[model samples]
Target: MDLVNHLEGRLLFAVPKKGRLNATALNLLEGADIQFRRENRLDIALVKNLPIALVFLPAADIPTFVGEGQCDLGITGFDQVAEHDARRRAIARDQAESGKSTPVEGAPAKGCEQVLDLDFGACKLQVQVPVKGKYRTPADLIGKNIGTSFVSLAAEYFAKLEAEADAANGEAPGAKPLRTKIIELSGSVEAACALGVADGIVDLVESGETMKAAGLEAIDTVISTKAILIKSKNPSNKTLVDLIASRIQGVISAQQYVLCQYNVERKNLDAVCKVTPGRRAATINALEEEGWVAVSSMVEKKRIATVMDELSKLGAEDILVVGILNTPKPDELSEELLNANTMSSPQPSPPTQRRSSSPPQQQEKESSLSRLVIAPLTFISFLLSLFLVDTYTTSSRRRDRGPRSRGSWLSALLWRQKPGSPY
Candidate 1:
């Protein structure tokens, strides 16, 4: 089936609606000129130029929505995707009944197929504690109340840690009676430790700004995350899906690096080319100066300053770094993206015939019902919340702009005045 067939004649794209993720998601789409208009009553957004609908959702909830087939595509952090196991659960079920039954024991789950790695949303999930604490390893987190937005991921990691601990103790590993509590926090996870709510936090660290401000220090890195594009379990339209995916990939490629140009002596052309990696930079035209060759190339944004300094030191002249809007370079990104797309296009597995060592009938029935019915409901609620935010935001703006009472006006005027200024 095609994308139009799956998404009710509309190619559905899901993005985080608010906060840091929302800003980055919208910026990425805008960079590609994929503008969207939101409906007042529904959570669905209509893409003006493309045959698509955009759904604004929380970054953490995107995986479940995509896995449940509520959306054809989504952009979210790799950490949230891994923590929720939303993709893994879907892939596990898919592999369980694809005839060949590709074992999902250690492989990626079929919940969401990664399309591309968005370079933004760079963060590491680190184990953090008070700056003066003695904790130095994952072992210190054992039997400690850990606060995190990534409850499932924390649990999985801790379980592994406990198993290792048990093996060292010469005991068979199984469920233990550990007293540690896994508190699932919505936000302000770092503050939990300062406020004495938890002993430590498992949270995303960008530049360690928030952690430093809160007097916390990272002790161990659990995982590093970047933004990724994910596709639905049973994509309705392949053409639309591939087209959208390609466009997104192009946008990401354009954002990561700038095109550099310069002039160099023909004798030094080989050396200049070697300095400009990605092989994207090439010789263009020659100057009036004999043996002077003009060169053009692509350099990663982070390396631009360093490349410029190096080129200048090496006698390269007029080295200009121009921002790239878009390019058709297919070899820019890793082959992992292409591999992901190819592997994820197949149909998902049906509920039954998924496991060789199946659970008892009642257990299987419950599992199927939860996976097929309740899981979708949870995802639906998340999708609806995206729309609800738009409704609330519109209503809020209207109320804020309405006429205010005399007392309210007085408060506003007083609050806007300088602290020490006379009336």
Candidate 2:
């Protein structure tokens, strides 16, 4: 069977095959209710319940796959995306300088856009040096070798530093500009400095335990990054892409928030609202007991305990916090269901209509009626204006006329237009 033909008309989603982000990405998809089963030794997995195919690739390569339009959406780290973007920009610059329209071999045609932050696999890319080494700052590593997996990002950082150093020197005669060499290391970047392969290293630090275990200390942080959802700049199926994004956003929201419910006195309802304002507005319901109300709201999980305490102080009773397993955004699930129903239902063709000449004849008559009405109204309006001007000029010439006499002409015109007056 041809898997390529099988995947036609389906969204290609790229995910990390194996790495820190791989497990978390899969868990997020499960939370979003995207069911899929990957067979052993296979790179692609078809979603069981949706028109989506998951393509397993390295986290570092996911960005390139999405950017090149080979995949519609992907999950990767922000650090990888930044590195890929930097490489793309460098390639574009080189192409422009060389006056070539063709892209460099292995270069992505375009860059991907970040859709959502997955809020996992949190880490930072930092410049690490020997714990007891003299390198204390990023500047201290000038003219030193820096090893990193992110070659483009590391080179870009050092280029900025070199530019700054040159500017500070102010073109001093015979002064040599300091340049940092960026060495690309695919794995075990922490051992680069200890192995004498590089003076310092730039690498991802989650808890700093690994760096410390390897006898290294972070001198400066380059960028903080975490797992992120990215999409192609131009998607093949925009509706499906948006649907997936909405589902993931809902899952993240569900994880972050808890539903809080309580009963309170009507008089204290105002104060309770101020505490648990919910996402949009608090749900208020009249209780069976007079002067009492039940309120339900969504509150951040981290602050649920504090919120309960505040509600208790405000005379709230029967307070309960409920965990949400899944919560899609408003109208998102309904819209998808509606689209599915529409596709599954058979559409009937409309009855054919015979060509008719009545429309042109009706339009001509309407135009003629408009011309007739407008011509008479315009003529009457012109006559009325002439009479008013003649009356005003004649009144102004009469010096003996009093102010009341000057106003008489206007008043007479108004009186003629009264309900029972004749023209």
- How does each model score on lDDT? 0.73, 0.82
Q: After superposing candidate 1 on the true structure, give the runs of residues whose Cα lies further than 4 Å from its correct spot.
A: 1-7, 39-42, 86-110, 132-136, 174-179, 194-196, 277-281, 285-292, 305-319, 332-423
Error of 2 at 372 (Å): 75
Which prediction has the highest TM-score against the true structure?
2
- Candidate 2 structure quality by residue, lDDT tens digits, 1-423: 456678988999999999898888899999888999998888999998999999999999999999999999999999999999999877777687778856469764476999999899999999999989988888888899999999999988887777777789895433233378888999999999999999999999999999999999988888999999999987889999999999898788778877777788899999999999977778787654557777777788999999999999999987866666656773334221222222223432212222221245575788898899988898999999998788766655553455324257564554334466332
Evaluated at residue 12, the lDDT of candidate 2 is 97
Ten contiguous residues with the weakest lDDT in model 1: 335-344
lDDT tens digits, residues 1-423, model 1?
A: 132333457877888877667788887788667877665655667777887888878888888888777788999999878876733644455576566565458653346778888888899999899887767777888888999988877776776788888899899766565445789898999999988898899999999999999989988888999988888877767788887777777677666766676777778777777788553335355554556766667678888898888888778876656666654334665421232222223423322242221235666688899999999999999998887676556544544686433334434443343567532
Q: Which pairs clash in the backbone of model 1? A: 2-236, 2-237, 3-236, 3-237, 87-111, 91-110, 91-111, 94-349, 281-297
Model 1 lDDT at residue 322: 63
